[model samples]
Structures are given as structure tokens and as C-alpha cells.
Target: MIPAAFDYKAPTTVEEALSAMAEAGDDGKVIAGGQSLLPVMRMRMNAPEVLIDLGKVSSLRGISDEGDSIRIGAMTTYQSVLDDASVKEHLVLLHKVVETIADPQIRHRGTLGGSVAHADPAGDVGAATLALEATMVIAGSGGEREVPASEFFKGLFDTAVDEGELLVALRFPKHTGWGAHYEKFVRVAHQWAIVAVAATVKADGGTISEARVAFTNMGDRPLRATSVEQALAGASATEDAVRQACASAADGTSPPSDLNGDADYRRSIAPVLTRRAVLAAAEA
Candidate 1:
């Protein structure tokens, strides 16, 4: 289906983009890589009067190292992240997660900021970011402010990015020397994850010292499995220990019921995936 006609603005600078958004008000839409928004627009599910394009904004398209952490521009594509040595060395969980998102074509066009802002509960990036404790940098007329991943995702397809604001970048604290893995289950190749788990662990002398775990498609937003994380800490990094700790993976989740599986089915699989993710991460 064709999209409804709309006015387009390609702003080369963040300031200009903000101005355009302000002028369009409620009728405006900000587009990054367009991997998500364009599909919705073509289906006529969304028809903004003004389409603000940020592609020309050169500043929003690179990855930079910041000592203890790294900052990824909102417009940076998944391919770019995959190619960055810093990301591979410092943020292994993110690297693993991005590699599983769709295919090469989508990865080349999908931007981190776009996925994060889209806030889809099934998106692979959100679960990794939530587990990594990433921070979002939102730009608005009031200047830039940061929101932690824990508070950034509000609900299904919703986020903390308010009106007249743009997600300029994401800041991730480095998880160097940690074992990380992303375990995703899909019905077919390139399909959205039916259930996924992202885990990163820190171990010392074969014992788990710290752990962070989050889930995809297990709730309205990517959720941290706090109970599992607590259970994994100070535990042995073996299959038995990991499986026992992951037993409560579905404790507080509200997974959706669809053709792929029902809520109960998803609840049953959460622990299985969580155990796999944690054990693999511990071994990495």
C-alpha cells in the first residue's frame, strides 16, 4: 500500500530538525533510519503531515569512545556498530544482540536510536540495552537530558522521548572482561523473537560475581530479570546452578498471547532461554 502524501524536511543540523518539529507540532514525525516508521506509514497506520528527516544531520551518525563508556549516535546503523572494534571489545552483549536483528539489509539501514525509540517489546536491541544499563540522550528545545534504560521504556511501542524531542544518542557503560550472550527464539529465520534473553556475567575463579539479565517479548517492555540476577550472584557458573537460578524468570512478566504462542507458553519458555543465556554468557 502507498503512504498518504506528506511534506518532508531534511534537516542537516539538530537545531534545524528541532525547529521543524516545533513548527509541525502534533502533525510532525521524526525519521531516523526509517526501518520501523516507514513500514507503518506505508500501511497507513500513521500519516504525519510533516516528515522530518534527520539523515542529513552529520553529527548523529558515528560511534565514539568515552573512556569508561561509549556513545553511539542516534543515526548510526547496525552495520556500523557491528564493524566498530570498540563496540566488539567493550560492549560484547550489544554486539551479539545487533548481529541477530533481522538480516544484513535491515541491519545496514536500521539505526540504534530508531529501534530504541520505537520501543518495541520484541526488538532485540532493547533487551541488550536494558541488561547493559544503557542511557539515552534526548535532545529538545530545552537542551539535552539523559534517561536510563530502566526508565526509558515506558510500555509497548512507547518511550520516554516526549513531544518536540529527538533521541540524539545512546551512552553505554563498558562491560569489558565480562561474559555476554543473547539467546533468542524465533519461529523462522529473521522472524521477531518469540522469546529472548540477554545476559552478561562477571565471574572470578569459576564463581559468578555479578550478573545482569533482561528479557524480550516477556512483557510490555524489555524487563530486567532482577530475581534471576540476584540468584546468579555468588553462585557457581555451572548448568545446574544457572538452571536453578533461572527458574523464576517469568515471575513478574506479562507476555503476550499470539499465533506463535500463548502467554502460558511464553512463561514456560522464559526460564529455559534464561538458563541458556546465562550459562553461555558465563562461558564466554
Candidate 2:
């Protein structure tokens, strides 16, 4: 299907992009890579008066080490994150999650910021970022402000990015030497996760010291499995221990019922996937 006609502006700078968005007001939409938005537009689900493209925005397209954390530009592609040495060494969970995001072509074109900004519950990036406690940098006409990943995702297809604001970058604290794993369940290869878990653990002498667990497609937003995290602390890094801790993985989630599966089905499998994810992370 052909999308409705709209004015397009390819801005080279974030400021220019923001200005375009501001000028377009509520009818303007910001696009990066167009991996997610274009499809929606093509189906006539969204028709904005002005389309602000950030593809040429140089400032929003790189990765940098920020001492204690790593800063990834909003336009940084999934493939770039998978290839970065710093990401592999410091943010292993992110690298692992990025590796499972669709196939190579999607990975090359999908931007990290774009995925988070789109805030799809089934997306692979949001749960990992929520588990890592990443921070989002948003730019607006007023100025820049930082928002934590927990607060960044509001609901399905919704985020903290307002009408005239743009997500500039994401900052993730270095979790060096941490064992990380992303457990995704899909009926077919590269399909959106029916239920997925992201786990990153820090262990000492075979005992689990700390852990972060979050789920994708378990709710309207990426949900942190706090009960599981609390239970894993000071527990043995073994299959039985991880399985017991993950029993409550779906306790508070309200998963959607769709053609893929019903809410009950997702809830039933959450713990199974959580156990696999946590144990693998602990062993990594």
C-alpha cells in the first residue's frame, strides 16, 4: 500500500531535526532508519504532515566510551552494536540481545534508539535496556533531559518522547565481566519474540551475587522481573536454584492474547524461559 503524501526533511543535525519537528507540531513524525515507521506509514496506519528524517544527522550516529558507561547515539544500528569491541566487553547483555534482533538486513537498518523509541513490547532491545538500567537522552526545543529506561517506556507503541522531542542517545553502565544471555522464544527464525527474557548476572565463587531480569512481550511494556531478581540474590548458580527463582517470572505481567498465543500461554512459558535465561547468564 502507498502511504499518504507527506513532506520529508532530512536533517543533518539534531537541532535541525528538532526544529523541523517543532515546526510540524503534532503532525510531525521523526524517523530513524525507517525500519519501523515506514511499514506503519505504508499501511496507512500513520500519516503525518511532515516526516523529519534523522538519517543524515551525524551527531546521532556513533558509539563512544564515557568512562563508567558507554554512550550510543540514537541512530546507531544494531549491527554496529554487535561489532563494537567496547559493547562486547562491557555490555555483553546488549550485544547478546542485538544478535537476536531479526536477521542481518534488519540488524543493519534498525537503530537502537529507534527500537526503544518505538517501544514495541515484542521488540528485543527494550527488555535488555531495562535490565541494564540504561538511560535515554532526549532533545527538545527547551533543551536536553535524561530519562531512565524504566520510565522511558510508557506503554505499547508509546514512549516518553513527546511530540516535539527527539531521542538523542542511550547510556548504559559498564557491566564488565558479567554473565549475560538473551533467551527469546519464537515459532520461526527472526520472528518477533512470543516471550523473551534478558538476564545478566554477576557471580562470585559460584554463588549469584547480583542479577537483572526483564521480559519482553510479557506486558504492555518491557517488565522487570523483580521477584526473580530478589530471589536469585545469594542463591546458588545452579539449574534448580535458577528455576525456583524464576517461578514468579510472570506473576505480575498482563501479556496480550493474539494469534501467536493467548495470555495464559505466555504466562505459562515465562518461567521456563526465565530459568533458561538466568542459568545461561550465570554460566556465561
Candidate 3:
């Protein structure tokens, strides 16, 4: 397969990138890591007239620690995060999840922002971002705005990021090893998760202080199982309590049926999978 002939522009600045997008209008596409876009283009699924490359935008690449959260530049590669000593110390769960993101080659080339911007519901970054309650900073023609993780995901392969906007960075609350776990269900590595769950818990003297539960590929968007969270909070960090919370995973989801697995099977297995993830995270 061959892609449609298109113009390419690599911008070194945020303003320049936005301006390029504005000029190209609807026919222009932003290229971050191109991990997903290239494949789509090759398949002729998308035929952009112009491709705005963000590879040279310095402002969109790096990781920093904010007062209460970690701010990561959009261009940060998964490999960089994997090797980051700071991320390992404070946000180990993120590293844990990244380990399961595609394979080493993809990790080396894929940008975190690109993954989120692609808005694949089954992506590890999508679910992990939701579980961490992160915020995505998007800069557009008018100005900059932020979207919370819960609201950022709108549907499969869709997000709150608007036209002529570049996702600049991702901000997450400072994590101090709150029991965190990410469990992915796939027949093999590098496959889109049939269903995945990420769980984070804060424990105070063996009692659950706080809990966050997010699911991947269970619906049109990555979902936060708030019902499960509420049930786990302040409950004993026991298998029984984890099981109880897991039991309600499908309380509000409308999971879709697909070739990988059926809706009924995913619905039933999600809870059990989530329980194991919760327990693993609680032990962290």
C-alpha cells in the first residue's frame, strides 16, 4: 500500500507548529512519533495534504517534576521514561505499564504524547493516564488549555484534543509508590489488549486510604471504575475486599463485542482481571 503524496513541514517551535496546522487547515495532520499515523497513512486510511512534524520542537520533549505532579513533555519517548531513574523512584507504576507497551522497537520510537493523542482506548498510556488522574496540556491557535484524564478520552481513536492543537505535556500527581498495578490481557505480546486494568491504592496502616481503578478496551473510551474505587476506599486491603470492588467493574460499562473477544466474556473477565491487578498494586 502507498500513501497519498503529501507535503511535510517540521516545526521547531510550538507557535510555528500551530501556525502550520492553521495554514494547512483540515487537510494537515500533526506527526509526533508517527508510530500510529504512519501505519494509517500507509494503509490509505488517512490522506493528509500536509504533515506537521513536531520532532524538532524542544518545548514538547522532556520530563520535569511539578510541585504536586510530574510534568512530561509530549515528545518524551517510552524508552527514556523506562531509563529515567526519577520516574522509577516516584512513578514506578508508569514504568511497569510501559514495559508492556508494544515492544522495544516501538518503545524507542513512540512518543508518550503521540500515544495519548492517537487516543487508542486499548493503549497502555490511555488507561495508565486515567488511573493516575493526569492532565493533558494542549496548545492551539487561540491559547493553551488543559484536559483532565477522565475527560480527555472521548471515544475509540478519539480525544478531547482539538484541531490546530498540539498536545504539549502530560501532568500527573506526584506518586510515592501507592500500590499500583497494570494487568493486560492479550494472547501475545504487542497485541492490543483484549482488556486491561490499572489499579492504584494508598494504604494507611493496612486500611485502604484511596483507590483508583481504570480499564482499557472495555468500551469506547478508557473508563474509570468509580464504583470499584468507592467500594475499595477505606476497605481492608484483603482479597475479599478487592474481589468485592472487582465485582462491580461492569456496573456502568457498555463493552463492545469484537473478534478478539466477545462482550459477555470481557465483561465477566474484566472484574477478575481487575481484582488481580488491584491486589498486585496494593502489594506494591
Candidate 4:
């Protein structure tokens, strides 16, 4: 398939990129990594009149530790993230989940901000950020504003990143010493998850003090399983207790049925994966 003809602009700075987007108005699309947008364009699903490329934007591509939180630039690649010592040491859940996204080549090219901005329900990174309660830093002509991960994803392929705005960085609160795990259910190697769970728990004296459970592909967007979190809090960090808590894994989800599996099948397997993820985190 061939995409429609469109104008393109490669900006080296945030200001230039924003100006380009403002000039193109609603007909422009900003591209970073091109992993998600290119495929959509080739299929004729989107035919933007102008394409603003952020490949040359140096400011949007690095990892910085800011005392209590880590700020990851929007254009930073997955491979870069996987290789960062700060992420591996403090944000272990994110480090574990990113290793499962696509393959090495895709990881080298795909950007974290791109995935978050794309807001794909099946994307692994979003669930981890949601579970960690990260913050999104958005930049536009009016200046910059921070949006919480919980309020960022509005629906399937939808987000709070409005027109003329760019996601510059993601700020994650440090989760040092927390036990974390990402449980992904895929049909084969290098495939998107049919259903995945991200679990992070803080345990004390063999009892769970706090827990954050998030699910991917369980709804129109990455969802926090509040019911499961509540069930696990204050419970013993044991397999039996984890299984009992995970029984409500699919209670509030609206999972989609596709070639991979039906809604009922996903619903039935949610608890299984949740239990596994929770137990792994507890044991870690």
C-alpha cells in the first residue's frame, strides 16, 4: 500500500517542531521513531497533509535522574532505556517490561514517548507507567504542563495530548527496593501480548503492605486493577492469598475479542496471569 503525498519537516529543536505543527494546523502529524505512525499511514488509515519529524531533536533523547524521580526524554529509544543503569536500578518493573517489546531492531528504533503518545491498549510500557503513577510532561505553544499517567490515556488510541502539543518527557517516581514483575501472555515469540499484567508490591514481615496492579489489553486503554490491589493489600504474601486476590482480575474490564482469543477466554486467563505476576513480585 502507498500513502498519500504529504509535506515533511525535520526539526532539530522543540520550538521549531512546535512552530511547524502550529503552521500545519490540524492537518499535520508529528513523528518520532515512525514505528507506529508509518504503518498506519501506509494503510491509508491516516493521510496527514504535513509530517513533522522529531528525529533531529537532541533535547528529546536522554535519561536524567532528578533526585526523587527520573525524567526520560520522549525521543529516547527502548534499547537506550534497557541499557540505562538508573532505570534498571530504580524502575525495575519498566526495565522488565521493556525487554519484551517487539525485538532488538524495533527496540532500537521505537521511542518510549511514541508508545505513550500512541496510547495502544496492548503496549507494554503504558501499563508499567500507569502502575507506577508516572507523570507526562507535554509542551506546546502555550508552554508546558504535566499530566498524570492515569489521566493521560482517555480511550483506545486516544490521549490527552491535544493538537499542537508534544510529549517531551515522562517523570517516574523512584521505586527503589520495591519487588516488581511483568507477566506477559503471548502466543509466540516477539508477538504482542494477548494479555499482560504488571505488578509491584511492597512487602513487610511476609505481609503485603502496598500493591499496584495494572493490565494491558483489558480495556480501551491500560487499566489499573483497583479491585485486585485492594484485595492484596494487608494480605499474606503467599500463593493462596495472591490467587484469591486475583479472582477479580477481569471484574471491571471490557476486553476486546480478536484472532488471538475471545473475550471470555481473555477474561478466564486474566486471573491466572495476575496471580502469577503478583506471586513473582512478592517473591522477588
Q: Residues 98-176, candidate 4: write the lDDT tens digits.
A: 9999999999999999999999999999999999999999998899999999999999999999888999999999999
Models 1 onward score TM values of 0.99, 0.98, 0.97, 0.98
Could you give candidate 3's per-residue lDDT for residues 1-284 as a string of tens digits? Answer: 98999999999999999999999999999998889999999999999999999999999989897778888999999998888877777776787888888889999999999999998777888888888889999998788999999899888888898876889999988778687888999988689899999888888777888888888888888899998999888888889987986797987787878888898988999999989988888887
Q: Compute the lDDT of residue 234 as modeled in candidate 3.
A: 86
Q: Cα RMSD to native, each candidate? A: 0.7, 0.8, 1.2, 1.0
Could you say which candidate leads in lDDT?
1
User: Which pairs, if any, clash in model 1?
Assistant: none
lDDT of 1 by residue, 1-284 (tens): 99999999999999999999999999999998899999999999999999999999999999999999999999999999999999999999999999999999999999999999999999999998889999999999999999999999999889999988999999999999999999999999999999999999999888999999999999999999999999999999999999999999999999999999999999999999999999999999
Q: Which stretches of model 2 miss by more than 4 angstroms? A: none
Two-way lDDT contest, 1 vs 2, winner: 1
Which residue pairs in model 3 clash with each other? none
Worst 10 residues of 3 by lDDT: 84-93
